[model samples]
Target chain A: MSKPVSKFYLGVDIGSLTTKVVMVDEESRIIARATGRTGFSGREVASRLAASLLIELQLSEKDVAATVATGYGRVTFPADREMSEITCQARGIYQLFNKAETVIDIGGQDSKVIKVLPGGKVSDFTMNDKCAAGTGRFLEVMAGALEVDVKELGGLAEEASDSCSISSICTVFAESEVISHIAAGRTKPDIVAGVCNSVAARVAALTARTGLAPDVVFTGGVARNKGVVNALAAQLGTRLLIPDEPEITAALGAALFARDIAPKNKPCV
Target chain B: MAEQRRYRPLASTRQLEKTMTRYYALTRYHRLWGRPLRRPLAWVTSGAPVELLLAFNIHPVYPENYGAICGTRKVSAKLCKVAEAAGYSQDLCSYARSHIGSIMRPDLAPMGGLPRPDLLVACNNICGTVLKWYEALARIFNVPLLVLDTPYLPGEVTGHAVGYVHEQLKEMAADLEKITGRRFDARGLEKRLLLSKETISLWREIREFCRAEPSPLNAPDLFIHMAPIVVLRGTKQSLKYYRQLRDEVKHRVDQGLGAVENEKIRLVWDNIAIWYRLFAFFKDFSQRGACFVTDTYSGGWAVELSPGDPLESLASTYTEIFLNRSLEFRARQMIDLIKDFNAHGFVMHSNRSCKPYSLVQEVIRRQVMRETGVPGLMVEADMADSRVFANEPVKNRVQAFIETLEA
Candidate 1:
């Protein structure tokens, strides 16, 4: 029998919007997780985040069995294992919720919908990276337009009974549409809710094409927005199972993948 | 009223015919006639004749265009025989093959062609493929070559960027004047700018017509729609042709017909056309009724000028296009297109030949999907150059993606 690895594993998700890091022991139990806004220096941000997490956990780099990097800036991070977000998320979601058939990750700058198969493999997926309409930036723009903070937009979305409709899917035009809606006497909460609905609708539209298998797990920064999550759930016609910390799914997936690879470092049974 | 009356057809059939002929001709090729200056022509020591050489006082020559001309004219096949003997692949960019082919028969002008260029300007903005492309031609023709180095703008166009590009345009103008031994005429330049804007306006109108409930044309067919830009940019014929095309599209939209007979899916095309497998790639979409309602090209032409400052706006517009901007800017553009066209999803060409365009595609694909909740697929292929196009792989991936979307 192979000796058990006393090693910790690290997973870093260096995304355009935010960089996420997660650490786990050999058994795949999450030890620590770090979420930080990524600016111009993604590598530096990811490295610092991982280093701090290691220190917080009182673990050394040598104790790490394997490291995996995933997300848009996955390759940018200097990690031992560079798996695509697809592989990382697939493994990560499978570990968290075994029943998750489709995984939708809406990041700060981009969004992805992965069709997960039986064994935690990505059967198919679709991504939209060309626009800022359904991204965090879109929310920020809408927030600024509404004269509210982005963090507050979600709660604001929950407050309204009668929501305003924003037809322009273009971020710039949507901002204008929001302003016009306000001018047309739509309540701020309703407009915010409409924006959330619009964003969820866009994602739902893309995911609908992929043929979502229910027990869908929604992860990513945008998933933190209760309004968006609910809106998405409503649109997909499925109850979304939000992980305890949805944002760390990619990093968690990366860490899980690190564990899967860690066993390879040991002798076969 | 007088202006309308003056332009009206006369009673005589001859007058009517001339009027109709002029109207149609102007509607087709009128953009070619407004030559701002009667420029002196320079003879190339060796190469095809420049199309605008006789018309413009400035010497006109494009190595790549000349290379394409050779291949289209059928002389490249003979030259490929020589290059093949010297161990060049037949599957390289057709322009490169044709240019190298031209070199083998230096004495012969390949039956009919332009004289060799006195000067060659190669810009790496469109694709890095052209840097080496023109290097081959520079070696072959032994001409003075100027390489315009455009740093890849990663996100948005700032004021500093507009200034930098404007400076570069000025430098290009200086180089042209020095090569032609002529003075730079602002008025002359203004006319060209006006013509270009007119052409762009017509193109914008045609593209805008595609936003109709049933868009008038599919994305692949846009390759044909875009002919005037490449063949006659900065020419009156291009302007006239665009007007004609715009008229045709307007008529079609008015009649309420889908651009393609049965457009199954409305898609936004990202990246440049895969020129090598252009027909086949487009056919794959057209056969499926997946109409490309809009594209990055139309977005590029979506430039409008503030009144009374056309030249400045042209300079600004050219520099600020999504092509000239950062990946973030391009992402925004893509999002804008998908939303504007009411596109169901996007098919981003992860063009192998154009790295600048394709490198951030995966990221953009992810971001666009995330933010807009729009579905996107990246089809790996090359822009223009055929050698890098992996047909089967691209076809399979596209087919799978389409099926996934349809599903």
Candidate 2:
């Protein structure tokens, strides 16, 4: 790993809930990846993660050719360029699955569906309004109401044989609906499945609004949850492709953007 | 943020300021002069038949334009809260809420709010909110409410619709005669319509100047310069201002100057300007060499006055506004704007307050994009209310749109 390389591109995605970093070589291949909670200061977390990853690879600052940052906290992070996560996510997804024409990403604070062109260009897109109902934060709130771990809700939903309907789209209202379902002696597994279906339904509507294409790719932090993926697939009536590390896709795309800008700006170090 | 390339400021803006300020001053002091001169002041909607009001010698004031002032001054939030505290829902048009709020607390308002009105005039051509908004004004000011209900046109303007609207205009003339104590002046109406036609031609020509390779004017320039055309339409002052603005813009075109330096992307904007962030929002695009060459909002006031009876022209022109038209018509307008302006793309403001303008924008965006073979971005934000705007996400959408255009 300590090859004393002359150029390395870095991509940083400081999302609402997490910060992800990916380092790539000159060939545009990912070399090293890192992820951690964004905490109160995404800038510091992103800097720390990127620095540590560089140290682990036995490279110093001078070895990095260029860097691009994306996500909510992108502006605060020091990078050669800052880009929107929509383009970053589409680029990352396209790199992984070239057949991906549509992408559905559910982040902590927002959900978006992107129509991606070849080479990861964003042809069109739609994001959820100022609401958390279709996002990862909604999942966290419902999991808390059910006294279940957010990560474990997926397993519970996967095991549920029957589902309770969750109709409220507001996160606060939907959480109360979950509480009522629990009070009415609905099984926790069934309620969890209902919550998953609610998120799926919300995102599916956004996908339809953008006019979904075949080979839709599901991404973002919430894509790690199998239950929502299954429900969203059923709602879309299409096979959904999941990347190995969905949360890091935007960071990967940022890396690709960095690579795009690096050759012209190679450091004289 | 890079080496400071920005919009080229137009010199006509100084004249524009003086002209608008004089109009405001005249309205503000209308109580003193209008009362002594026997000129009755009327609070009117943007789409009201103003030529008819001018025929009655009525001093027309626009609450919608005033609402834009509050928004531009960044006091809409303060004024809107006053209305919300008085039980107005947030879903109501911000202009109506802010105007109502200003009336409630004049001290918090710019220019101590608009002067009291002798009567209220509203037209439902733009939106249904104006009917209710003007009704509220009538109750507050103890003035008579005159409404012209232009039936929504699902297709082209019909004979029945025109006749119905023309009858309403004649009835409105009767109402104005009663309120202003002046008999209907048909010659005066014709004169005003002729002035309106010439003034609007100047504006359309000014907009057409943007068809040049690098547009001379941006959306902000249009939004700022459009004040007279809206409130002062059918007047000599309005026509004079447009003539001056047209010359200045025409000069820019002759000199090969652009509003956005280098003007890499020329875009057609849909819906109202985000007044609170007009310059700041457009600055984002201008900094990246993207210029809003033209927009549908400002162009709404630039429609040609029909070449017929003054009353019939007023009826058809006011009723056939872009907001009153169907989605297909709106899409066609957008598609035409993109093509005529030589725009790389278009942006639709999914305004929370203006339902008629924003509700069908996605459908229009899709249709326009499909036909035009260009990308369209839908930005969700209110025209006057900053509370509904999520800046980070909006930047994300805008940046991605620009990036896609580059690709």
Candidate 3:
């Protein structure tokens, strides 16, 4: 007799910078996960990783009950259902911390503050996607100007005695300000701290527009940066709860939706 | 590949094009026929008392409408640059900026720019920007400027406010007589007022047709068809055009055909349109089976003429415009619209060009949501300048807002 097959839900998140896939079981437990650079072909990256995860779990495509896609490139991925990152992120955070009232997600190209209401729903949200000043791309560009890996920015800023000030909210203008600081013999750590502080300030203003609440949760690629996390907490004057593997929150949220909301026999790629 | 969605073009689109084309041609070639007819061309604001001008044998031209044309042609950015270079602040109303730019460079303007005006008329009822905007135009064209100072109504229209506007209208008539070299016949004014009232009533009825299930018209329909009501008011042609539009929309309602295919969710719109992406932006919502059934911007012309003396009626009607009212009044207006249209939600365009309309919108949004129990989404973009439009962000918000409603 063949062993009884286990059913699973699959979620793929295709962001501007990276793609993440998460598999969850019937009870919403994480079964397996994968991540890859999005590059120019988000669809290819997402599909390849999803298939690889299925293979690793010793299962065929039929074992997956439902598939959901979420992110900036959500529409590009073939799935049974597509949802915006805002709804997905709010769901993911509410699952982990039921008391979470506000979520600040700073992604690769955009930053958003979502007001999480009771019942794991989004009450209101605001985003700064018109420009890249306060997003992960902003830090990456400033990191390149300082000749340092973006990963080292948090630790370097922690060691700085004094932080500089970046007045411009534009990425290009901020880059020139950093160069001039370098030319004036300012230390890289101070400049890095300043960049982080400026990002925190920009995000704080955006959060104020949505009316921040207690038990704020931070999730996204930028949330992994310790310096930015510390600065944002200080600026907002509230403690932020960072989830384990913050980058997968949105994907995990999508998988949770597939597990809880997607109807049986729903067609998926 | 995903199936591509297409919107059905309205049957009256061809007629609209023909009517607008002939109207612009007449305005453009006015020198040829206007002199023979002895009709002086007067550039007027959208909210100016155009019926009064028509009674004085003056041909009215709207720079605001021409600004919309430039926006549709995607040349507003270049025209705005010319005005900016000429020392107008970039922060000024983009419509005003683009109009000034066209005046400075007619070679770069659409249809060789608007015809030169023998006089300029402006009303402060819409926004204080028009007063400054027309002042700049009067300086450039070396023409007489007539200003109508309608005090903003913080609440109900006060007797003092009507009196102030009435005094100004009497002075404006004398000024119009001097500029056009024609008398302001009270009987002619009464006739024009009656015509304006009938046209506005027709527009109101056309908008009310959207109350039907699976609305017969959408925001773009109202936006496009309102041109004649704005420029050609007090004329028989305006009434004729609306009579045709009203019947076609009524037919659509009778057939139960919606503006959007398979309409699922109905929405109400606030603020000026993002003219640069009007069709494309609405297509995104329409593809999702969400149709904007009505809007506050275009409905400004649908108010009934008050029951009083003709000039007194114009005073109260024009002074109590939606933009000129207090936030509480605007909020109530939106609530009434949402309830009347049976809208599931509302979208607010936080327009960067118009300050008085865009500012205090957040407060109003919260109020409307609290009262209606339906969600509201605010998208920030310039109405004319496409530069401020962030496509990805807007799409994500719209998609998410719709998802909430679906859930």
* TM-score of the first chain alone, every candidate: 0.93, 0.97, 0.95
Q: Tens-digit lDDT track for model 3 on B1-407?
A: 87665465688777878878988999999999888888989999999988888889889999999999898889999999999999999889889988999989999999989999988999988899999999988888899999998898889999999988988898998888777788889899889999988999999999999999898887888888888898898998888889999889889999997887888999999998888898988887888888899999999999888778878877888888889899999999999999999999999999889999999898998899889988899998888887778898888899889878777
The candidate that wins on TM-score is 2
Inter-residue clash pairs, candidate 2: none
Supply DockQ values for each candidate: 0.02, 0.77, 0.54
TM-score of chain B of 3: 0.98
Candidate 3, DockQ to 2 decimals?
Answer: 0.54
Stronger candidate by DockQ (1 vs 2):
2
RMSD of 3: 2.8
**Candidate 2: deviation at residue B86, Å?**
1.2
Report lDDT (CA) for all predictions.
Answer: 0.68, 0.91, 0.89
Per-model TM-score, in order, reads 0.51, 0.98, 0.93
lDDT, residue B40, candidate 2: 90
lDDT of 3 by residue, A42-142 (tens): 99999999999988887778778888999988999989899998888888888888999999998889899988888779888888848898999999999
Mark the regions of model 2 whose C-alpha exceeds 4 Å error after superposition.
A264-269, B1-5
* Residue B378 error, candidate 1, Å: 1.8
**Candidates sorted by DockQ, best first:** 2, 3, 1
Off by over 4 Å in 3: A1-4, A180-189, A260-269, B1-9, B85-87, B104-108
What DockQ results for candidate 2?
0.77
